[model samples]
Target: MKILLNKFLPKWMVLIIDQLIMSWSFALSFFVVRQFEFAEILRGHFLIYIGLFCIVSLITFYSMRVHTGLIRYSSIHDIYRIFSAVLICSVAYAAFVALWLAPVHNIDSVNIYLVLLLNFFIASTLLIMVRLGAKALFLYIRSGTAGSKERVLIYGADGYSILLKQALEASNSGYFSIIGFLDDDPHKIDKDIHQKRVYHVNDIENLQRKFNIDKLFVFNEDLKSEFRKKSIEKCVELGIKVLTVPPTEQWMSGNLSMKQIKNLKIEDLLQRPPIVIENKQVASDLAGKRVLITGGAGSIGSEIVRQVLSYNPELVVICDQAESPLHELQLEIKELFPDANVAVCICDVTNFNRMYSLFKDFTPEVVYHAAAYKHVPMMESNPCEAILTNVLGTKNLADLSLTFDVEKFVMISTDKAVNPTNIMGTSKRIAEIYIQSLNNISGKKINGNNPAGVAEPQTKFITTRFGNVLGSNGSVIPRFRSQIEKGGPVTVTHPEITRYFMTIPEAVQLVLEAGTMGKGGEIFIFDMGEPVKIVDLATKMIKLAGLVPNVDINVVFTGLRPGEKLYEELLNEKELTIPTHHSKIKISKVRNYDYEDVVNDIEELLKLNKNKEELRVVKKMKQIVPEYISNNSRFEQLDMHMN
Candidate 1:
């Protein structure tokens, strides 16, 4: 019966019902004026009077479309429509009686003006009350009456909070009930919104105790990072789930739904303030210039590509050996920036002839060399591949950049290169040394007396070194997420192991700023904020997934993998950093390397076949980087023998 009524009610029936109520209100007003004498209503042309009132009321209601709204979902706007219809009917009836009807019919039973006013008030009130009652009943029925609903406290007392509450009440999900609001604004504290008290954020514990708040909904787009982090931490500690709604603009058709709200993740808490860059300098360096980016499909390199495109580069050559990822990147670029001048090159950097052809063809003004094998354990086992890519590939790019007279070459290095204990880190350090030495020699040749057959050097090599990037491929965060999805033990290398972390975009922004700020031969080190312990990170991730750490999901400490370290360093013991204009960036000072000798040693190291004599390659690497020490691996024996 309820379904039939909800589905089959027509607009004309609503119009007829409103007219009948207004007629009844008119009759009741006469009865009240006549001192409860029901007979007095029938004394003087009462039937004609009621007929006139209905005619005027129907005209006004129809014109206003007051019957168009569904009663069960009526809003304040529907009330306004009802009021307008009543007021218009009252005015028309008063004018008809005073100017025309009284003289034509000689009817003087009661004051028509007072009767019309009374009808207006009674009719408008009844109409609004019916709609409100229906709306409330519908909400109650949709929200269900059986199970205990989870009480939710909204974190902001604003428009979004009100809308979220309305959405929750209207949804038939029967999962959540909004208790009240919590705001940081002092003036808003203790105030009432929608009959719910707004309390300060500090009152969360009291509210939780009183209302048993099972969740907190944060909808404030302008929330500060520190306060957000603190609130999330407090919520986690109290075992209350924290959720967030999408931004106001993202709401669908000015309506929010329960599906739009999502549980807050560990990433939200770990995010730092946005990095500010010297845009003018970066634009000046990149604008209208041809730029080449190796590993353009990978995380750091792809971010560099996206950021560089914003600077309006004349052409961007995306060079990566991976075909599928490069194709995906190309498709994304086409969708995002169809007019962007971009070309994809699927050639390995180590392919000297192909790279030479590319350089000769395009003659890039700047090159961002971000291609490297970064997985520690994988690179530990495949030392030869790591050296081939990180060392020889870098050398190939550097030599070609100089030969092609590229204006600037920005090489992406890592914190692992500092005080290296792993083959990957050592190879990167070797790349860094060779590039710095090449830059020094190029500068000397440019400044010195011109020798026969010697060309003026143009390429300036700059290296930007930072730590792990969040959300990068094969990073710990993704691994933890996968493990959590599988509902099993999350593996950590060591309980005490720690590493600095930064967002990929932030790291790339600093890289661009450092690249633009460099003159030549400078290694730029970024200030990666506090290092995070891997075990704590895993525990937090598990908890954020609504699972109890070590109970629902276990974090097992596997012994550190080969080439792994308990702590990572941004600078070697022998190198110190000098301040730069940007506080987050610094310039590293290290002993200069002899360019010819470093090049000859790298050539010798590359010539040794890993298939036949891998130890000889390791020994040669140790010879190049005197600080290279192997720990907890088979290569440690080589170190012992050398000692």
Candidate 2:
């Protein structure tokens, strides 16, 4: 590009030099037109104006932030600015010539205006032509230069792979010549994308050796874990760079600019599964309705609030105990949608009286109860606080949402609820039962007004069950990043332990979609794609960061936490599920309790949690989620381990 600009600058200088050639030619034409020597001398003054005009225009172009740098790929707006600047400067010179020379040199206004008009028309045409021509030549030279173009390969022979290829060829985004695709699928072998063949994965080396390939762009959506390490190793052996593009970002739009492309990010290295968004109807019930998001500063709560805002809700109340995150959320909401009527509230969900008042004042049509003590280790140590926040806090909100006539309530749950062996999961299971039993008991009691020309409110309760969010607070990804930055062993509990993962947007979107799908007493389970082993995850991260695993950094095996599992199950041994809109998400079938009986038991448990034995609450949790079984946890030895 720099060389092309250098070539373009000399051509422009030659055009300036043509002013002298044109001057001598015009003098010869004048001698022919008037057949006199005096007329020939008039071309001298004309030659001076032509030379001065070109010099002044070139100087003004540089001052206007044009011409000095490469303008081959400049936008139309840039060209317009250049033309405007040159035209203004040329017109000013024409005015000065007519004002002074009209009386002294006897030059006419008509001739001066004609020269000004023609100069602008010709200068704009020539300037634009030079810019466009330079860009074409730059691309030609860039593509044609020996050993300059990078030979790049892509993994996955799918729709995204094709889009990635087209985007690279059609735009100045990635500076790579896409050779073809690499896939393990036998059916895709020898197939073509944009006339480029989809070769077998085994053939990547032959191509790398043949063409001297530089990089491999893997589609993160279709990456298989077992082969990921092998694929990365192959690239490293061949001294080739490996890059990845997120499936969602496969369709690049307005953000594609040369300058922007240079500032690339590494999100594609994250190996989370493809997000399957099925429940689109979840947000329908929330449209134009007042909504409240407790723990709004948190990962799940913040996402819920953001998704709710998109539905054009009547009002959104963001409540959280944390002050710093609340202030940040306030600024974000204000900047995103200035017209939105959003309230930033600093009410802790554990403070029953305060939370109850806040819920009553706003009277949210839908309440997303997300606040809880979720960190496994933290909740394990402070069992009482977890009970107070997750168990009692849920009870308070669920009761208020019922009493204040809220339309619907959605609770965010985890797979840990399936046979919970820790305080956090146990506390959540208690809350889940309270929501389920209440829906069974309170049917249509929240009707807005009287039956005769009055509003009728039917409170509906829905619970969204899913696994870990990728980059949430206290997530393992951030922990690994921190550990890796410290340049040492990155800890993994067990080489065989694995867990399901999803991006924040994907999880929250599914929650919104599922929320609107429920018809009271339904537990929505999101299909978190394949589970990635913790050991393999650390290995991939090390490779992505350009470090050799087990050599440069070690993977330490730390014993699992208090109630941690080697493998997490989405459902219990007896639990069954049926499909909904998308195959990945489902509705779990579980036993429902009579509203009054369960509610009475929960109220007794809440009081007992304060004065009675802790086993009383643990036993109630076991009863609610019948699948719940005590695993390798202190909670199982309640009385024996109390001391």
Candidate 3:
């Protein structure tokens, strides 16, 4: 049986089999009509009649290509093809008898016509039955030997869901046994589609109890709908694994494969509504302009590079200190946009001469500064490095943009920069101040603030601040996912600690929008919907992995790391945000700084950092940004002393 079902028969072989089946049908018809009188049937032109019928069947079936479809994978179209072929053969035979046989010989036309009609019915039925019977037999034997197939249920009862079901069954992977469909429509519920029952969405629990369902398949759009989101969550809570079907565009050759159906990830459920951007506005800003993206290989920066490249920029300079990642980004850009003119520069943003040469060479009209050491605890241990890169790197780009008369300088900031309790956040806050102050400096030489000999700086400095990006480098989501994959003891910083989460794409979209709308000296903050608890995130991640939270894998809550806060703030106590044209973005009403004072303080801080004065560097950072109070760190002592 396995050998027979292993591969499809050749078309010629299938044609022979079909003709033999039709001949058998003709013999059965004769037996029925003659009342088993074999002597009477053989006494006349029975041999010639059967020979003529076989020739007609062969011509009609071969012309219709009815044998082209695989018998084991037959569909409704195949059945229709077979039926049409048989009907045409029957009609042609009748025409032949009337035109040639009936006139030339004394024959009973009624009996011949009756036999032809019976042959048509018998042949059609037998052909369709043969294919269906083969399919059923194959499925039955395969199921019995291929282990117990997982009984699954599909979420939607629409045409897409039905097509998905057909695709899965026709693949012959022998893994899923679809029990029924769960639909929210009252008209579709309790109805049968393609021999599968459609149950109400509310009946998932009952269906689980009855059939012991192993998985629930859903379309991609269901994740965006509020009602469907809750339904999926309910299934997750009930411990049924949820699988999501990719969008139609992702299908291979317009057909869904078993590999295309992926397990739903926690990030999919946590995502907010789709962000709509002003495409024309962004295109106008970036089109045909030389754009530079610092740290272009990192998560946020890489997404920025991709989005900006789509705007048809004249040239894109992807600069980063990391050699391998920078090379990889260059390769990716070449693969994705073969016509795009992109340059890759491997140089530290902290080196003045290197950055100066970069600016002189590329001379980007728009600069997106994303280079910074962003980890909180890691920067807490090494404060000076944070200041040097985050503050100095930003200053280098901002000052160069002014000297080169760049149109805009957009700096990526963080929510932690608001009430900065860590060195990383404080350093970012200092960078923001320098950017804002430079934008506020009206037509001044900056008191001889190193190079950039200009009367009035033409650069529009902008800052975009947002919360933690989901799936970014060293983020909690990826960490939790890794821990769950290893099979035990997923660690959460604290049970009660919560942080605002946004997808990397979402953050980058808002940044581009903010950059487009910024005039200068304005700090833009994205609307992070709500704070998610660390423990809950861990639990959902474990559950998404098809494991129980506490039973299958233990979630251990370690104490918060140094300089980690229970909550991240987008706005400080003294600042307020006003709504912008885009709902997801707002401009912060932050205090303006004196350009001279900011320049003086930052220059001294850079000198201290250069001298490796870590303590002095951090102390000077606190003095520059008064909100730089440390939390749960050795630097917290410094905060207390200042108070």
Candidate 4:
């Protein structure tokens, strides 16, 4: 029977049914007026009046689309339509009787008005009630047929909360049943919303016990971070799955759905306030310029490429050695900006001739150098590759930028370069030093020499440094997520280890902003918020996955890998940062290097073969970066021997 009703009836059938109900209502109204005298209602003008009422009601109902809604899925809109149709029919009938019929037939006006009013009330009420009853019956059938429904509680009692409940109820899946609402507002506590009592957030445990809530849906916009964290923590402790709806703008066709509700992620919890960028400054610098981005297919590189498109660059040259990722980026750019001019260059940055040729062909006005070998442990084991890519690769781009007279060359450096502890860090530090010295030397030469005496280099070398980017290739977050999905122990290098984190987009935005602000020879450092402990992060991730840390999922502490530091530093002790126009960005003050000496040292360092004499290569690195200390690795012995 329910299945048959689920098959929606045709519009004509619904119209016919509604007309029949209106006719029955009119007859019932007459019987009530005439004290159940059926003979009088069947006589004279009564039959004609009933026929006219049916015709007018059918016309109004069809005009208002009152019969267009499915009885089993009727909503408030459908009810309003029904009311409109009945009210219009009643008004038309009263006007006819009062204006013509009552005076001509010598009938009482009050009696006629009363009969029409009663007819309108009965018709509207019965029509709405039948639809409501059918809707309830369908819901009951669905709830019973779909197996056991998970009892859930909403964490907010606001408008979004009500919408969420409606969406869940309307869902054909019938998996979730909303038990009640939980809010932080003291005044709202004990109040009823949408037929559900609103309980204080503190009463979650009690509510869970009473209602057996298996899930909690969070939809509050003004929820405090601390309170949110605590509430989620409590929910995890109670074994209640926490789900969240997307922002209202993301809703499909202004309607929410169960499919749109997703499990809260660790990234969502750890995310800080969004970093606002000075768009005008970035746009002014980049507009109409041909921008070249090295390693433009990697995580940070790709994001930079995407963001740079907004400034309307004359041509964007995406240069990367990785062929497949670069191809992927080219396709993405083509799809997103088919009209914009973009070029893809599969040139290795370490190959000087190739990069030189690239620079000559493109003649890019600005160069954003983001290519580097950044994995600490991997680079520690393969120090030769690290130097070849990170250090020499940067030098090739920097030298070519100067030679090509590019307006600005921005080098993307990392926090690990500050007071380095690994091969990767030291290599990046060396790169930073080379570019800064090159900037200073070039500026001095241009200022000191006559224009005819020497061809002046007019390039500004800018460096932007920040900490780890969330969800980057081979980052800890993805690794932890994969481990959780595999249902095993998530690996942590050290329990006490901590690192600063920022989203990839945020880091790239600041880089662009810093590029515009740089004059020459300045290393801009971003303000990375408080470092997060690895152990705490791992624990939270496990809990977010609905598993107890060390109980449901074991968190194993693997001893620190080679050259991996206990904590990463944003600035070396010797370096002091001066204020920038943006509070989140600062300019670092460091000791200047002689361009000649630094060039000689790097040339010699790059000369050694790492496979035959790895220690010799590492010793040269330490010499270049005196503060480079090897921790928990074979390179540590080199530091002791040097001392």
| Top candidate, metric lDDT | 3
With a 3 Å backbone cut-off (N, CA, C), the pairs that clash in candidate 4 are none
> Ten-residue segment with the worst summed lDDT in candidate 1?
445-454
What TM-score against the true fold does each predicted structure earn?
Answer: 0.85, 0.71, 0.89, 0.87
lDDT of 3 by residue, 362-395 (tens): 8899999998999999999998889879998898
Misplaced by over 4 Å in model 2 are 1-66, 69-202, 208-214, 217-240, 244-283, 444-457, 612-627, 636-643
Candidates sorted by lDDT, best first: 3, 4, 1, 2
Q: Is candidate 1 or candidate 3 better by lDDT?
A: 3
Deviation from native of the Cα of residue 530 in model 2, angstroms: 1.4
Every candidate's lDDT: 0.85, 0.71, 0.88, 0.85
| Ranking 2 against 4 by lDDT, winner | 4
**Candidate 1 steric clashes:** 0
Candidate with better TM-score, 1 vs 3: 3
- Model 2: per-residue lDDT, tens digit, 1-643? 5355245455456444334333333334434434555655576466665555555555665566554444545557668875786577666667667667567777555654665665566556666776677667766766765365678887778877776675565454355687888888899899777789888878877988787887777655444464754665577556567765665453454323333222111234343445555434554676688999998999889888888898789999999999998898889988988899998899878787798779768878888988888988777767667778887888778777777777788899888877776777777877787788878755445323222221334678888888887889988888887888899689998889898887888888787877777788888888887887888778766765667778998999988887787777677666689799666679988777776776667667677678746667666655655555555666666534432
